[model samples]
Target: MIREFFKHLPASVDPQTRDLAEQQLVGYACTRRPDDFAPLVAHLDSILSPDGDYDEDEDEDGKPKPKKRRDAFFYL
Candidate 1:
């Protein structure tokens, strides 16, 4: 949906501005399902990056921490 939003954004708006808006929207969606989205959310910057896949430090155990899982409809 956000991709479509940016695709249909006004021509007057700059690409950078549109990208920021898309990121904000995606961020909101991620917040809404942090656990479900955590894998993607954790990689959001990379996902949004032009080159993709930035380097990130591992946790103390040198393992990527798993996202906490929660029911998708928990809030309802």
Candidate 2:
């Protein structure tokens, strides 16, 4: 099932990122049960989404503030 999820990842994702994601997924699968799949998928979806919550304030050069990476293992 986790393999299926990795297969479905976006093609635009770079090889390095995809490989890292696969490793992360495999680690998650090892530590979790079958029933945890739904939440795992949802978590992956959130990270993969291009749209993210950002502050209205701009950086010194006027670009939008970058979003910070959240801890993926928070839910656990």
Compare the candidates by lDDT and give the number of the best one.
Answer: 2
Tens digits of per-residue lDDT for model 2, 1-76 = 5555555555666889777877888888788876685587657856864443334678899898876443333233
Clashing residue pairs in candidate 1 (N, C-alpha, C atoms within 3 angstroms):
none
Per-prediction TM-score:
0.37, 0.54
Q: What is the TM-score of candidate 2?
A: 0.54
Q: For model 2, state the Cα shift of residue 39 in Å.
A: 0.9
User: Which 10 successive residues of model 1 have the least lDDT summed?
Assistant: 67-76
Segments in model 2 whose C-alpha atoms lie over 4 Å from true places? 49-76
Clash number by candidate, in order:
0, 0
Compose the digit string of candidate 1's lDDT tens values, residues 1-76: 4453443344555678667766776777757664564444334433444333223546799987554332222222
